[model samples]
Target: MGVLTGRTALVTGAGRGIGRGIAERLARDGARVAVHYGSREETAKETVAAIEEAGGSAFAIRARLGVPGDAETLWREFDRHADGLDILVNNAGIGTSRPFGEIDEEEYGRLFAVNVKAPHFITQLGAGRLRDGGRIVNISSGLARTAAMPQLMAYAMTKGALDVFTRDLAKVLGPRGITVNSVAPGIVDTDVNADWLRASEEAWQGAAAYSALGRVGTPADIGDVVAFLASPDGRWVTGHWLDATGGSLT
Candidate 1:
């Protein structure tokens, strides 16, 4: 049987890119997946259809995080489709490459609202519904540590906070047999980051060179690591910050 047979997983922001990749992987592993999308209904439905075509069970849900009561609404929608949840991947986030000085207050507020507050409350609600021995994988970024550029101050802060949440929540939920961890990916090539890379091939190559592995990371690279963490093989791992950076830290 698949490691996650009979399990249920909720993947937020799963309409595209890394989130889509992770959701697909979980479904392929025998889990009934709740594919959550913020505002991309078409992409969300497409994700669900793809899973069904692959002979996996999946359903689409819509809830924009960062709004009041959005978390509660999400769980309610999830309950309508599945009896319980075993995995929650907090993959929704928003930020920009503008320098710290250039980012206005409105932009900063929006970034924090989405990047930090959304995940915090989403996990809060998921905790109540997540079954014993559940797993949560928060998608963070390698920039949390390196601060590669001034434009990343706000984004890095949010991810740094998420890492702290991972450590603390692991302790809080440890007694309940739930595993909480963060996966920090480095410079993944996704639609979200495509424009920046396309600005210049040198920019993309520079990011690749930063990694000791000497290549840019794909969404699947991060997805594979997340799938492992959500599987039985990763049961012993919790309260850990996994570095999926292709040796970038080294």
Candidate 2:
């Protein structure tokens, strides 16, 4: 039997890309997963279908983040499918649509609303349902620590806040045996990055060169790391910011 055979997991923004990857991994390890998506019902269904096809179980939930009552709405849907949560992966976030200087107030507010406020409130409201010994994995970005992409300052700012949330939350949730950690990824090959890499082969090569591994990271790479932390073996590690950047930060 899988280590998480009876555990339940919730992965936000799990419709596609890294979020979907994380959800699939948790399900593969035998956890019945809740795949949460903001607007893409099709993508969420695809994620659920993929998991079920692999002999795992999963359900889809929707909540338009950055709006009023997003967290509460998410948990409402989540509660309907599962009684309590054993793992919570806050992976939903919006990208920096343009350079920092060009972004206006509305865009900036939306970014923080979805990227920062949503997860914060989600954890706050959902923690009660998070059984003791649960795991909380926040999907952070390498940009939070490095100024590699100065143009993405606003987005980086949001992730930096998320890192802080991960650190402080671990302490708050520790007594219950819950582990909260940040997984910072660098340039995973996903749709969130398509605009940046689709420019040319030069762009793709440049992104890969940043990693000492000499290849672009994939969603599966990030998924495996999350699965490790969500499993029993990860019980002792908490409040740590894990570098899943494939040596890009080194």
Question: Tens digit of lDDT per residue, candidate 1, span 128-209?
Answer: 8899999999999888887466768888888999999999999999998889999999888888888987679899899799
Model 2 lDDT tens row, 1-250: 8989999999999999999999999999999999999999999999999999999999999999999999999999998999999999999999765686698999999999999999999999999999999999999998888756768888999999999999999999999999999999998999978987868999999999999999889999999999999999999889999999999988
All candidates: CA RMSD in angstroms?
1.3, 1.0
Give the runs in model 1 whose Cα sits over 4 Å from its true position: none
**Please, what's the RMSD in Å of model 2?**
1.0
Model 2: lDDT of residue 203: 98
Instruction: Report every candidate's CA lDDT.
Output: 0.89, 0.94
Error of 1 at 7 (Å): 0.5
TM-score of each: 0.96, 0.98
Residue clash pairs of candidate 2: none
Local error of candidate 2 at 162, Å?
Answer: 0.4
